[model samples]
Target: MDFYLTALVQGLCYGSLALGIYISMKIFNIPDITTDGSYTLGGAVTAVMLTNNQPTYLILPVVIGVGAVAGALTGLIHTKLKVNALLAGILVMTALYSLNLTIMGRSNLPLSNLPSLFTLVDISTDTNLNTFWIVLAFIAIVTLFIGYLLKTDFGIAMRATGNSESMIRALGVNTDKMKIIGLALANALTALSGYLITQWQGFADISMGIGVVISGLGSVIIAETLIRSLSITSVWLNLLLVLGGAIVFQMVLAFTLSTGVNPLYLKAVTSTFVLLIVGLPRLFRREV
Candidate 1:
């Protein structure tokens, strides 16, 4: 039970990542690999600030800002330079590795003794339970904000920019600018995940972001599958489903670990599971 609860908490922590991926992949049709770097940038920034006794409130904005900048750089490279979107993301992600190291001044930074967002409020007697509530509240706020944004005229334009770039551009909606802003928003959310997770886990390592994009992608895929099956069209419900998908993905991993699989093979298991999620749908559709 404790293991499942921990998984639930972690799933909530990654909710922001799922949403970020949804924005970049589903909305903008970009496989923004900058997720691998901006995520760690968030953790790196959070760990450094907490260690310096910075308030949690102050750190949140900084994490979002830094993450946005990293994303914007990728967007600029892809748009202004007319580079392939994937290659542009790869470039920014690679650069962020060294930049993250510079910010942290080390390969890892521990925050076990430092104050963090999880330590800000005590909602329950059990530590995990308290962390769960805090993470839940934070994710709820983020989801609401994103849901609201997607329903606005600007948000509609952003979505249209993704759905029909040529058409939207023909309508005078600077498609390039929309892509840049969309990527910036996506990465900011991804960074927010890093910020939450680092504090919850009590440390940030330079390598923590490695392969993290897979998890986010998997969650988004799961949500997409559900959306298709149920024919869900409401934007707000779609966002909530994405959050649920993140939790469900984590729960699946927890179940795998509980089955006594070797920890070293965890990544392999993750990859296989994601492959099934992505491939099985097409395979079944082909049979029809």
Candidate 2:
């Protein structure tokens, strides 16, 4: 029971990242690979700052800003330099790998003394605030912030840009700016998740971002499958569904690990699961 509870909490953190990916992939219609790098960027920055005695509260905004800048750089490459959006994200992600290494000044950094938001909570209890509560808080805050942002005027414009670039331009909306804003918001959310992950785990490693993009996408796909039947058409529901998907994915991973599955083969299992889920919908359908 304790093991499942722990996995559930950890899953929430991972789910937060998946929600971020869903915004870019499903809502914005932009398959940005910047998530892989931006996630590391957040961890690197947070770990370094925490080691230097920075406040955890401030880490949130700083990580978000840093992530936005990274995403904006990718957007500029694609929109301004006319690079393919897909390739531009890859370029930014590649550059960020080195940048994260530089920020941490090493391959990994530990956060032993640094305070986490969970630790600072006013709940006076000997029991270390369980991972479940901490992750739940982060998820709640992020979901609320993102849901609010998506309901704003600019958010609507950004969605319009995704649906029809020419149409948005025809309406006199600056599609380039919208795209940039969308990317920034999407990646910033991802970075925030990375920050939480670092603090939760007590350390940050450069290689942690590896295959993260695929993991996030997998969560989104799984979430869509579960909540596709929901009557709620709002984007906020989609966010919740993605979170649900992440939790499920994490639980499955934990179960596999506990069942004597080799850790090294975890990625293989995830990949196979994602493929089955993605292909299953198409394998049985017939053309009308």
RMSD of each: 0.6, 1.9
**For candidate 1, lDDT tens digit of each residue in 26-144?**
99999999999999999999999999999999999999999999999999999999999999999999999999999999999998778788888989999989999999999999999
TM-score of each: 0.99, 0.94
Flag regions of model 2 displaced more than 4 Å.
122-129, 227-232
Q: Model 1 TM-score?
A: 0.99
Q: Across residues 1-288, which tens digit of lDDT does each residue of candidate 2 receive? A: 767777787788787688778878887788899999999999899999899888888888999999999988988898899998899999999999999999999998998866886676755353334556666877898888888877898778877788888998999998888878788888898898788889888899999898888778888888777666456567788788888888888888889889999999999988887898788866766532
How many backbone clashes does every candidate have?
0, 0
Clashing pairs in 2: none
- The window of 10 residues in a row where model 1 has the poorest summed lDDT is 111-120
Residue pairs in candidate 1 whose N, alpha carbon or C atoms collide under 3 angstroms? none
